[model samples]
Target: MNALVQKSTASLDALKRIHPLMPWFASFVLLLPLPLLALNDYQIYLLNVICIMIILATGLNIVKGFCGQVTVGHVALYAIGAYTSGVLSVKFGVPFWFCLPAAIAVTMLAGALVGIPSFRLEGAYLALATLGFAQSVEIYIRVTNYLGSASGLGGIAPPSIGNFVFYDYFRYYYLVMPFMLIAVYASFAILRSATGRAFMAVREDALSAAATGVNVRRYKLIAFMLSAVYAGLAGSLFAHMVPGYVHPNNFTVIEMVTLLLMVVLGGIGNIWGGIIGAILVTIIADLTRDFYFYQLLMFGLVIVGTVLFMPKGIGGIIDRYFVSKRFVAAREKTAEQKRAEAAAAKSGES
Candidate 1:
């Protein structure tokens, strides 16, 4: 009995020891094939989209998943990023390297601005306001000629590394994957830090978090800005991927909702969950395109099913299943040992 307890304890400790490094290793293994594998243009394009979406989802997860903020306007920040890079690259002839930081900074400021007033409301009200905010941004894009007036900035060029241009989707895939990994790592690092704990605290209970000196407003703004940064970077990468085209209409309220869905489907508050969920959802959405009208309906049903059955998202469901399986096995083993001990005692008594 004592030996079994010690064995179980050791196993738990082992899991704890390896848990930190596991995700990083997994990400590398999953993404490493892009540069090495012989993938076609379509597959590369899909991977590019997946990588970009994962970056966006990870950012959104910071606000919606980690901090528990209901931001349905995340794509507005993406639009800001897309426009910032697009306009600069097309009009000012700014290099992609320079435009990338500008895009992130501009989007981060936009997020901070939106976070200030919109945060006054909570729950469904906040969600509604965010939805409105996204719509407003889209409207502004349509009305402002400086932002291409809905036509969006075109003729954008691929990023050049001193004359070496990334014109193909495969090259774009390699370039974008690094940023995605970095953004994902940063998201997880933030969650593991003291600031991350504060965000989680505020999410779990804002008043209590404030009472504990978490500076809820500051952290909330931080979450929004961080999320914006991710969106901006993803948008910049996305621009380079498309090379010559962009549309303000792409950053609609529906896009924000889709991003939110990715975070939810991935598992709110889990880094890998957000990434995995984004990939699965992206793949499913792409595959369903063959169904035309029924594709969207089916997608909605899948989301509903995930919420109703998985509850915690597919990743969470799988995690729970594994944990439950291991726990049940351990319990059964303990029970068997107890029964064996009891029989041995009874035999001695006889």
Candidate 2:
């Protein structure tokens, strides 16, 4: 087992060294044919949903996992992005391309607002503040006539290039996938930078982070803003997808809870965990569509079970497993080397 793992690791390392971006390029190539393989439009639509959820989960992971901020209002920011883009495209005749950036800017401002409370609050209190913010946004949208209230906004335009419109699931998948890839890649990049280190420092210990001049408040705000960018991009993509529309109910606490479930199940601080969790949850949700009553119950049970048995989440488990394998392999290699050295010494003496 040790030898196998060591060989596998060596192969992976060699591949990575040959071309650092090869894995990413290969993944993109693999995904390109997925729509063709799908049984129907519905499967393609589900794939699109998975891509959107990946963005959302990745963003939530930034705030909750990386920064250790207990926020429950991320869905509201998502809603803000969707509605902003939808309203612009529907009412103002703004193009989808313009709305995308505009929505991101607006959501980033909202994220900054959400982070304001984080400077003074922590844990449940910060969560409550964010929750209140989310509820307020929903309620405001529900009563605002201009924002479409209950009727919701429709007729949002899909993105186009030189007369070619991404109006179908197949076309939109291409549009969304690039953005999702960029978002995930950017996240990895950020987490490796100084800002990312500061965010983790705050997550691990705010007081200690402050003692080390980490600027905890600034990093927290940055985390929220970064996450908001992701949520905003996701919202714009979703709004511009087939059946372009934006509704208040879609951004409610229920949606927030679902997002939280994704982050938690993925492993709070693990990027890969968030991605895996989103994909898994979306697939499971699709499978259990008819069992709506038991869906939430099952999700709740999963969360509890994960917290109790696998606090690090699925990502953590995978990480630990690989680490253990490497450790065992190293031990075996060292023991063999020692045996070889001892035999050589004995032969020399003889």
Question: Whose lDDT is greatest here?
Answer: 2
C-alpha lDDT (0 to 100) for residue 142 of candidate 1: 89
Measured against the true structure, the TM-scores of the candidates, in listed sequence, are: 0.86, 0.96
Candidate 2 residue pairs that clash: none
Q: Could you tally the backbone clashes for each prediction?
A: 0, 0
Query: Once all C-alphas are superposed, what RMSD does model 1 give against the true structure?
Result: 4.6
lDDT for predicted candidate 2 compared with the true structure: 0.91
lDDT of 1 by residue, 223-330 (tens): 889999999998888876765578876787556656767887888877878888889878877786777567556657766887788778866976786688789889
lDDT of 2 by residue, 54-109 (tens): 99999989999989999999999999999999999999999988999999999999
Give per-residue lDDT, candidate 2, residue 304: 90
User: Any runs in candidate 1 off by more than 4 Å, and if so which?
Assistant: 1-26, 35-39, 329-350
What are the lDDT figures for the candidates, one per model? 0.83, 0.91
Question: What's the C-alpha lDDT at position 107 in model 2?
Answer: 92
TM-score of 1: 0.86
